[model samples]
Target chain A: MIGNAGDMNVVVCVKQIPDPANPGSLDANNNLDRSSKLIIDDSDMYGVEMALQLVHAAGSGEVSLVSMAPNGETAGLRTALAMGAEKAVLVSDDTLKGSDALGTAKVLAAAIKRIEGADLILAATESSDGYTGTTPVQVAEILGLPSVTFAKHIEVDGSTVKVQRQTEAGYDEVTCPLPALVTVTAGVVEPRYPSFKGIMAAKGKPLDQVTVADLGIDAAQVGGDGAGQKITNVTAAEARKAGEVVVDEGDAFQKIVAFLDQLKVI
Target chain B: MAKVWVLAESAGGKVSSLSLELLTKARELGDTVEAVAWGADTASIAGDLGAHGASTVHDLGDLGTSLPGVSVAAAIAAAIEAGTGPDILLVGQSYDGRDVAGRLSAKLDKPVLTNVVGLAAGEPPVASHAIFGGATIVEATFTGSAPFIYAVRPKSFAAEPSGGSATVAPLSVPETGATNAATVVDRHVEERSGPQLDEAAVVVSGGRGLGEAANYAMIEELAKLLKGAPGASRAIVDAGWVPYAYQVGQTGKTVKPTLYIAAGISGATQHMVGMKGSKNIIAINKDQEAPILQIADLGIVGDVHKVLPQLIEALKARS
Candidate 1:
């Protein structure tokens, strides 16, 4: 099957998120602050590597990176360029500054439409903040295209993609016609490191920017007001109590052995 | 109000565990939960869905044992359109559920919510997904309007009996674009005991502390007696202690069981995301300092070989 492979063009959607550990804070309205708490999520970074593999394989069509972060997400775009995306486009704007999954996809779809047509659009299954995991399907829906969620492996030929869709059990290899959207999971491929030379070259790549205004979108559609549901609150989970001691070690092993003896497995 | 739809998965006239779990959650979310079934005569499964709360069961005439998920999605969409559109479409988070939900959500312009453990509706339908392995919980609401389709996490919500008659009807498969896209040549299912992990309410997971792959027997033995599923840390899976399918972490499968037992494993944030949403967590590790102990509801500071045997014996006695 590899011998009969054809060239493929792939585009990936990347989002910058706050590190999950330090989810940081939200406002009175339960809104995540973009400027203060923004960095790229690790999963989206993997999405980049998946795209690179498709484009790098047999030198098919171009691999492009599209980010839907607030204005000044060019650093992420540059990062993608350094990692070897052929081009980068940032869909940024104040209106989209507070976009949720739907608004973000709306902006991204417009940005993707502006770019030269793509054979596939790649994305992570979910984002850390919203964690809703709805953007890919929403984008595919709005664009009137087919989509596969949580695709573990993708082999492409021009516009058609044979995707290994992962389920709770095993996986299924489903082929969908060209111009489909695929949201990937981890372990698809190890992301590449940006070399010094590649980093330098990335600085010179074109990074066209688009905002909600640029897309002729309703400003209300791009902000906190646009999110169909608002986050009511964010609080730390209740702390767990420490563990029980069945036995210590060495000498504790004997005590544990005694404990097990009581339970009667011995 | 448009009746909510639950797409019941079946093969050879029988429903999978995930379908039952989905029906359980669907009844919890909507007032009128109806099921859309396909593949052979699923009248029995339809009855089962009613026993677990289904107002209507729209059977699409058993398309086949392994119908393309996209084709099933088309049939579901057509049913939604012809009858009252489902207020929200609920599905299992399995492969077919994921495939059908992804295609249906896009085609229907509804939100796709995956790996959910719970469901509630206020304005937009909200679902809970165990993220960051299990350290954090995300309560996310669908992005848009009603009829939002979701592939809910199995075992996340408890199934209940809403016993009553369900309206069973026929739905024709729609020839959406994917009809000519790809065809399934054949399908082979991976065999494993210990209930489907995602569908298991009790999951006993092991880690490097087991010392050897054969040591997994202790964990498996306990899981079997309890009728629970067994999960492995990435390190154990990488060490070849267990198959990759059993690994539960950022790098492994995600499970939101009711009770999760972690034996002899240090918890990485990656590993925690997979099982954090478990209602109760118990960790037994030789290292009392293991990070897993931090999230454990009941932690036993000891080697798994010692603690596990005792625990297993206690369980066996009780049974």
Candidate 2:
């Protein structure tokens, strides 16, 4: 297979976010006021799975995990390493905090450029938390790579790839060469779990510590500076209240008439 | 001299609706708005762009086709690099837009705001965007060089008309060939039976209030009568009331229309972001205090199963 012996390098960019699939309430100013535990979003996991499949299929490639989460997110990167990534690179710094979608993409692209010379990169269609659905595109743009976003199906044959795009109305099929990028959509493929041995071996893997300075990057380039679009204010989402219910609980004939009269259902 | 630029996407060699809106919003921000089109139809760039208030349209000729981010950014950045780019770049907040905005910002070393709703360009570009699934509206301003990229949210700007002559120019792509990356052998668009989902001024969505599958016909009847596309809450889909494709929530699609009517909905935070952009929301639930009514412009306290049928009948009668 094409991947049999270090034929290509795969890079998966993942983010650590609070789970939104589980219902929860938000605090004032609209931040995820959750308990301080985080996990990798499912979208990123699917991305990792796709890369793993490609590497496994070609038989000669390695998968590398790259993330923008701070030291607090080390646990999540370690999990990626356990999931079969050969190594982990953590792009963390005080300067890289509070990043929105664009800022995060900038950080990932800069980090990707500095670490490994990658032939392919993948990410989730969108994060479950911010739900911007814009990161993949932004990341591609930042890296100056050709991108295929919202892909429901992806097939790589040697140097070229065939992608099935998910649209509101239907799906589209597109083809692109290697050294390209893709954002996998939900329901594309389920990511496998890290085996016990994989988990054990991951503890010995290098979780490289990189900051805004390691890549000759300035604080401004990280998140808070000129390269980012900073948020000045945050407003809570307005909630909705319940409405009145009208019922008719009489006999069949009378119930129809009453229900019609009360609900104007007639 | 402030100028706003719209990078348009094309289908079968014509511009897209979102591109039109991008140019319209850009026109709102600057004295001179430029619509840049690169693809099969370079000749029509000036005319289409001028119609949307583009004072200058650079037509990079017969450029095989613009890929998501590569070709689009190369053409746009080369212009900016050579000093023909606009003060602000407005793109539709879709996959293509994100790609272009990200690459353009990196190449130009400027700030790019994704999923931005509003823009104010002065000493710097301030853009209003949604965060935390529309729970918080974040106001952002970029302090960087010229040609800041913005992926504008949908329906934020009513695509208005601009009258001007499209002055076509035979522009050229940088050392990079006319084509960037990715080949477009075929493009498939989902067929809509009624008004387009994003364009529908009125949308009647189904929720847990829908009850079961057999009951969804009533909701469809209402949507068909109103000539609108139906939106489904995750509850209904999760409950097998409809397909997951119809679901509207944080993980699903984000849309805005003129009037949104959610029935049997409890108004979860994730669900609200998808429709909160609507100009008016009307919620009909049996529970008078159901969560869906908070953002509703008009809250109708009643059973949706009953109210919906009658409303459909009323709409049909009016028609």
Scored by DockQ, the top model is 2
Per-prediction DockQ comes to 0.26, 0.35
What DockQ would you assign to candidate 1?
Answer: 0.26
Candidate 2 local lDDT, residue B319? 64
> lDDT (CA) for every model shown?
0.69, 0.69
Q: Tell me the chain A TM-score of model 1.
A: 0.85
Q: In candidate 1, what are the lDDT values of residues A1-266, reduced to their tens digit?
A: 01124556678888777665554455455556555646667677778888888877747667787787765666667777888887877877766655666667777888788776677789887765655566776677667676777676778755567777664446667677777788887656677888999899998888877667777778886666775654433445545555354444434334433443453433
Tell me how far the alpha carbon of residue A229 in candidate 1 is from the true structure, in angstroms, after superposition: 1.9
User: Which of the CAPRI classes, incorrect, acceptable, medium or high, describes model 1?
Assistant: acceptable
Q: Write candidate 2's Cα lDDT for B179-211 as tens digits.
A: 256776666776557765566766778887777
The candidate that achieves the highest lDDT relative to the unseen native structure:
1
Clashes of each: 14, 28
